[model samples]
Target: MKKLFLITITLLTTLTINAQKVYSTDQSYKADVKVYVVDQEYQADLLVFKVNADYKAKGNEGKWFFTDAEYKAVKKIYFTDAAYKADLKVFFVDSEYKSGWKDKSKQHFMY
Candidate 1:
């Protein structure tokens, strides 16, 4: 029973660590990923949806929860004006179901 409990706890911890909890940083040097918001969805490498709760931010599937503090986030992102300066280019989607990687090549940036 103790082994089962430990396994369950470890699984939950791993899932939480892999969750898309992001913090927006003002300084680019402090950011883990430099992001650019594309005007059109076609121009984006990823389609992102902002979730209200952290628990809803699951996986690296682009469902992001903006954390109040940087310590609470899995990743820190800085928004760049130029697309060329960004590590990832994203487009905000209205629905969570629409959130996912448009370009699989740039998927590693979130991880």
Candidate 2:
């Protein structure tokens, strides 16, 4: 029973660490990552899907759950007006299945 409980705890911890819980900051200086929304899908480095629940925001596979408070977020990001000013360029997709990194080179920015 104790071993089972420990395994469950470890699994939950791993899930929580990989969860894409993000907070949007108003100030660019306060953000961990600067993001820009691209007009076209092909112009984006990442295809993002906004998940309805926090638990659904698993992995750095472009699944994101926006947190209300900064303290609850794994990453804090600021939206940039220009793609040149941004650290990452993203395009929001309608479906979760469509979410993924187009440029695998920029994948480490989320981690």
Query: TM-score for every candidate vs. truth?
Result: 0.93, 0.89
Off by over 4 Å in 1: none
* Per-model C-alpha RMSD: 1.2, 1.7
lDDT string, candidate 2, 1-111, tens digits: 999999999999888877899999999999989999999999999999999999899988999999999999989999999989999999999999999999999987888
Question: What pairs collide in candidate 1?
Answer: none
* lDDT tens per residue, model 1, 1-111: 999999999999989878999999999999999999999999999999999999999998999999999999999999999999999999999998999999999888888
**Residue 17 Cα positional deviation in candidate 2, in Å, after optimal superposition:** 2.1
Ten-residue stretch with the least lDDT total in model 2: 12-21
Clashes of each: 0, 0
Q: What TM-score does model 2 achieve against the real structure?
A: 0.89
